[model samples]
Target: MSSLVSFFAGAFIGGVVAYIFSRRVANVQFDNAKTRDKSQKKRYKDIYIRASNQRLSLGPYIVAIGGGTGLSTLLKGLKCFTRNITAIVTVTDEGGSSGRLRQEWGVLPPGDIRNCLLALAEDDSSLNRLLNFRFDRGELAGHSLGNLLLLAATEIAGDFRKGIEELNYMLAIRGQVLPVTTESVCLVGRTKNGSRVEGELNITTCGPDLEELWLEPRNAKPLPEVLKAISNADLIVLGPGSLFTSVIPNLLVEEVSNAILNSSAPVVYVCNLMTQPLETEGFSVWDHAKWIAKVLRRFPDFVVANSTPLPQDIASRYIAAGSMPLLVTPEEREKFKKIGVYLIEDKLYKINEEGSVRHDSVKLAECLVRIARSAREREIWKESIQFSGMSG
Candidate 1:
């Protein structure tokens, strides 16, 4: 009986010892996990702080002019380089959901502005998809949710410009977007044959070469903020978009064009990747630059052109759709140089899985930043030289 009692006591002591060891081990594991988590958090905090500092101190003031996917694409790339960006969007859209909204609500077209806002949003992955959601099989068919939200915002704010400002804040976008003009204006194109075409859609679709382009009323004033942005900009960029419809429409606003010309900032023009049917058919890089010069009344300081060739399948697809790549020849490069415009050529294109081509945004932004730095240095040197000469 005594032996049985001793065996039971030993078993009980063993169970107690095992429990205590397990509890100690669990406590050690918990402490280690806590330390690891704290270390990871510190690392994340350090990264965030560094990124914030770079954005604040390293970014330059830039004013980008144009409208359409081209401007949005550029914005997507540019926001990575600078927080001080002002996008001057053309307001003469007369087709698609923007057209419908304009006609129905009498508001400025929100499509391009929405796109720019999305491109600059802090977290655009889910929001981009959500806002770009289109409806079908209802009265809302063919209208994007973003357009509707912008329309609603305009109604709530009781002013178009105010509404846009509200959205700029609400979306927490990296930069500002301004319409070239707040007034209701129509695009009018005078064909080389002396025929007048009215509306952006018709003009883009019109077969004849455009000899002249102007805004209706001929006195559309620019937004005051646009001029201020131009005056404050360290660099100005124009066009990777349609020449007549997207880029030139802003220039047609006399005050906007004059401000751009008067600003001390150096202007750079990004040439289109492919020639659009009827709009820029058979046009070379020089041809695009010449048109911009004609409208701006002076040549841009630099022209960024893509020198990379498209894949065979993509090239064939684009050709089939009546579009061709804009090739820059050696002769054209010499012509640009003669005109005092620097030609920047590089492999600046990317082809999507669906055979669509676009400028590689990150690569393009890096190039623009490099150009801005060089231009700023040159300006400083020139100023210093002039000061020295005066002192002497």
Candidate 2:
């Protein structure tokens, strides 16, 4: 009897311990499930928001020409307005990871192109951060992952354009980004002192006023697609970038300049917020317009400039760096009007995330849309008058 009782007690204790263990495990699993559901709900919310934002993107077909952070900044803002955007980027870059790649693998500089791609990417925030990441150590030091990715894709696709296409599909970019040309072009500038400065990097710090800018291989044919974009665009935008290296270099291509002049689409030049050191040290709004007119032989229909003053802290920093806001005098405004270029000035600048004074993308986009809409309205009114006259 004693043996039987002892065996029964042990069995009861073992069963109770196992039951307690199972209950603890069940509780933990239930908590884990709740956490996963919460994560899924947040992700779903993000997707819903992105989808809703894109519904209002049927604004206009805009073509933006230029390069560097300024061009990309404009692109980032413009995407919110329209899905039909074509960014024509200058590829004369000779600095940073792009410079190294061009020197080693003999490819067109990828830095600016990469930036344009990220700017127009559908998943702008996350992918932009990823592509802009730079390695700090080892052989990859100072190299941008986006530049490397472009280089590899180019090699794999056997051409740069094809590689860009592949990335476009993978990233679901909002609009197209095209190089001005496929040839490895060099930016050459003639300083006012009659000294010649070659290469994009050297021209910026050449310490002289640039009087003329040109590209090597003067006969370089533009990518046919770029011409098509300009011809079909409702509006074309120029500048808000490096005056010599970015904006002028594109015009140096004879065919590209001709396309802009021939197209009925109105051309608008988005002037920079401040004069660059050594390039446009004391440039005013008129100076910027005249230089562009001199090269293209036709003035832009509209010139958009910032009318807002910079914050004192920001102004001081730029002043110390030998830069200042571009002044558009009343006389200059009248002169531009006499020459048929409408001056659209607004408070279009702000301190960007990096704490630098730059064009506010949304504000700039708003200004552009306003001009484009007004132009469209005028055209419609003219057509209506013609129709009424004929019917009468």
Candidate 3:
């Protein structure tokens, strides 16, 4: 009996020692795994940073011109491709929060500017939410937080342009947003009935076919920075926004049009997905391009148009709202070919969750990047040929 008890004691001691040793080994392995995970994470972060910096330096410089959601949408997509983007926004906004701020503060409308700024924001952060916030009551009722912020920023910086610069720096924005002009001006339109309407709000709401459209201050000069951006751009894009109010207003600035004409870069126009109720009722894609060419006295080298069909339900909704899909008829297409404009049509639009038609930003950006790449290849090929000829 004494020998058996001694044997049992020995077994218990051995079991405890074995368990403790295994536990220590497991803990050491776990510690090593954690350290390796951290190291891997850091390495990935470093690589991403380096890659982003490399793309920023090597990407082609692109200038996108328009206003409202269209320009912002383009910017959102293009930022994924290149950090070197310049958004030239129109300044003729005279409705909603922008109009109210303009009347009360005597400043250029901030509504469009705010949208561009948020679109170019590096991330969807608290600042973006703060800028998009809106007031529901009191003196600030119906005012957008971004418009008020821009107004305050203008006051703090002592100049509208400087205010934008400060905001851009604070946001670490991926690209630059420039107003088409600094002068405070209203959009004017003439009805086919020989009546004149002023202010963008009145003009759009008039519900009549517009005979002509112009700015209140006909000679509103384009900003020098805008001209410089155009001159330096590898590619220039126009529109995908309201044809008369958003797109053409930028071209109304004489210097802006001239710069576009003089620039060696290829100019591309993004046609709207649908005809706007009052602004572009019964219009076709060709009508939009024709109007643009008429206003600028020149046509774009290319037009990016949507070839996607809307879902049945979404199509019904738009039709109910009196909007129609902008179709590119065969005759109009021939017109584009005759004018030396390349019409690149693709599945460029989609219905968002809100049931509104929106351009696929990523897809659009891809097309623009492809075009830029092709342009570069052409440039290189031309240079090589010239060098060979000279040497020969």
Best by lDDT: 1
- Local accuracy of candidate 2 as per-residue lDDT tens digits, 1-392: 99999999989999899999899899899889899999999999999977756664656778899999899999989888777889998989999899999999998899988999999987788988888899999999999999999999999999988888878777888889888998999988888889998999888875337777788988988999999998887788997798777887888899999999998778999999998887777778788888889888888887888776888888999989999887578898889878767777777788868779888898788777655655555564212322111111
Per-model C-alpha lDDT, please? Answer: 0.86, 0.84, 0.84
Top candidate, metric TM-score: 1
Q: What shift in Å separates residue 79 of candidate 2 from its native position after superposition?
A: 0.6
Error of 3 at 40 (Å): 4.5
In model 1, state the lDDT of residue 152.
90
Give me the displacement of residue 88 in model 2, in angstroms: 0.2
TM-scores of the candidates are: 0.90, 0.83, 0.87
lDDT value, candidate 2, whole model: 0.84
Runs of candidate 1 with Cα error greater than 4 angstroms are 2-14, 17-32, 35-43, 46-50, 378-392
lDDT of 1 by residue, 1-392 (tens): 99999999999999999999999999999999999999999999999968885774568788899999899999999888888889999999988899999999999999998999898887789999999999986888999999899999889999889888988998988889998888999999888889999999988876338888899979988889999999988889997899888998998899888998998887989999999998888888888888888889998988888887888888888999989998789899789878777677887888767667998888887777766665566655222322111111
By TM-score, highest first, what's the ranking? Answer: 1, 3, 2
Could you tell me how far off, in angstroms, the CA of residue 206 lies in candidate 3 after the best superposition? 4.7
Better of 1 and 3 by lDDT: 1
What TM-score does model 3 achieve against the real structure? 0.87
Model 1 root mean square deviation, Cα atoms: 5.1
